[model samples]
Target: HVHGHFFALLSGYIDKFQLSEEWHRFTGDSSITDVRKCYGEPRAALHEVCKYACKFSDLDDPKLWEFHQGVNGGRMFDPAGNLRGVLTGELDQDSLEGLSGPYRDWVATWLWLEKKYHLQAGPPPTMLPYV
Candidate 1:
């Protein structure tokens, strides 16, 4: 069932992108690829994947700087594929606009409180003269 669903989705994607020949060349044997069912909360699994993708342990690591330079102007999220329209703002414009008002208000309030009282999420505001 999972393999069938995944193949259907892949077929749709290939057709949409006109990449049938390219996919065939890459796969070589179409029967080699398979999808297996996994049990877990989907949101948790997604969170774990995102954390692994964005993990940067040491700020002073040279590899981090190298990676940063390599992908400087490129989109770290989806450049193209299923998530292309989503990351590029082609979808959910209206829904995001509705969210912005409340989100902005919440941030504003949080900042005000942090400023008024020295609520220490980080170094106190006074310590950072530029801020």
Candidate 2:
């Protein structure tokens, strides 16, 4: 019974376990050589994955914003305090219930397609201060 709360919690795990610098310790590789290597394919870097995911605007709805907020909070914004992505919003408890399943499924589908097609580089989207 995955819900918005669960998805929010899972995002933290994804960032900490898959996207952090300590990922090398888990993968036993200093540099990520393969996108398939990490759990949820998160080793590719958030900006890269964000660009890849942004192609499908349908996936960028409020659920995505909530998920990122749960994981990284305001850290996604630029130093100038500009929020990333044109579509941004706050998620409420009511909306979370409806979006939970669809959000998870969409992410899974995106990762599978990304692996199958080997999507390449593009101009980084305007998200996160570091990006």
Candidate 3:
């Protein structure tokens, strides 16, 4: 069974992976193509097929506008400076490369939806000095 700590860790991941609001706005009008120009490439840009079962739960009671609220108790925000997305399930060394096509697009789409709805509400991370 998943532990409560797992959810907390997941939320932290999401936060770190999220793009700063400034970057979001700059690319807001830009098409996906434009985004590629500004942000280079995305890691695990596409969603991999669920070869095995994955888990999702409603942790924060997310609302339509309040995207962050629904964190689902994943606490996906990363504590590290760099960001990444976690792809769980029964993925292994070989299977990861094959799970392409719409699967990848799925992850990208979800990221877009999250940023569009619940952006950081400030300038880009580049501009923000470390605390």
Candidate 4:
């Protein structure tokens, strides 16, 4: 079953923005919980979904550090889904090699920037790439 509370929250925003038509097209036959469409173009809906989760700058340093400690060393997201074992390094090299390209490039770039700047990949990393 869909999470009614979350859907209601998004539905409120959809109604407020008068995006019923676009929302219908975006959801199609999928459950309300499905957010795969938000990753694509027309990111207004994605912004709605992420706004709450992304608001950390408003927090003061102590509160922010407390929040960090609460979630540190925990897996915050499961991007691998069914391929969790492979992503967690439990699988052989061939399986992992298939997933390398873009991810490898991104990490290499991030590492180079971090080392060059003597910085860590904090919530707001010091380096940002131009699109």
Candidate 5:
């Protein structure tokens, strides 16, 4: 699922703008409950994606922190995509561990690009990637 989502984002078949729109259309607000209401119960991995989106949107609020804490600190995601253990992939790992690994690194890289390009990967619509 993570592979498919990553490739969907990477291949230009579905851009962040489209995702942002879909997020807005589904969520109707920034609340995860709303996300659940519209998209059903999202996995822990999906929550990380939302956190990244919130960061991109400059959503420096307590709810975001709470959400982070709630979803992280568990090995739900697969760290190596190996099938040996529970392979939840990039979406289910704890926050600190993930920060030390590839997901957070990728987020940092995207943050750099966003800063350089003055773009955002989340809500408010206008700041999202155009292409």
Candidate 6:
């Protein structure tokens, strides 16, 4: 069911953002959990996404307030759309690997535009949450 969780995670984001990607339009016996197997991500690496969250936002601190706060959408989220904490596509370890030098440079340029424009992704955490 790990694959299902991952698909839930991805679809959670995709739907949350109204990403408008055709990849999500497929119809079949497919399950959201099968995304990794279908798209090819080592099953072991799936935990990477929430590793930091678990470490900092542990039982004592179930929510990583500071980390989410740093993610600003400038009051951009609304209850009607069901949007919440922002997602950083960059936190992926593979982000810069195998990319052209110029394109990589461009990505770096906008890495923190959220903080700069006062567009908090969700909320900022003053201290790392307990894992």
Worst 10 residues of 6 by lDDT: 101-110
- Give lDDT tens digits, candidate 2, residues 1-131: 11111112132223343433444543344533222223454434433444543443344547666765676744533422232354546542233211221122113234533433243434433232221
Model 1 C-alpha lDDT per residue in residues 1-131, reported as the tens digit of each score? 11122211011112323233434444443433333333466434333333443455333457768877988998755434443565445432444211111110001112222322121222222221211
Q: For each candidate, what TM-score against the reference?
A: 0.26, 0.16, 0.15, 0.28, 0.24, 0.17
CA lDDT of each candidate?
A: 0.34, 0.36, 0.28, 0.36, 0.38, 0.31
Candidate 6's C-alpha runs over 4 A off are 1-20, 23-43, 52-55, 58-79, 82-131
Model 4 lDDT per residue over 10-110, tens place: 21123333343444444443333333334334334434443444355356668868988998999866544344564444332344111211111111111
Candidate 2: Cα lDDT at 57: 38
lDDT of 3 by residue, 27-98 (tens): 443222112221223222212222111223222335433655555577664533222454556543444221
- TM-score attained by model 5: 0.24
Highest lDDT among the candidates is held by which one? 5
Q: Which candidate is the best by TM-score?
A: 4
Model 3 spans > 4 angstroms off: 1-62, 76-92, 95-108, 111-131
lDDT of each residue in 2-97, candidate 6, tens digit only: 111221212222333222232233222333322333345633343443343234434232244664665545553343322345455654355532
- Candidates in order: C-alpha RMSD to true structure: 17.3, 17.9, 19.0, 13.4, 15.3, 19.2
Model 2, 91: alpha-carbon shift in Å?
A: 29
Q: Against the hidden true structure, what lDDT does model 3 obtain?
A: 0.28
**Model 4 error, position 11 (Å):** 23
Residue 12 C-alpha lDDT in model 3: 19
What number of clashing residue pairs does each candidate have, in the order they appear? 0, 1, 23, 0, 5, 21
The whole-model C-alpha lDDT of candidate 2 against the native structure comes to 0.36
A best-first ranking of the candidates according to their lDDT comes to 5, 4, 2, 1, 6, 3
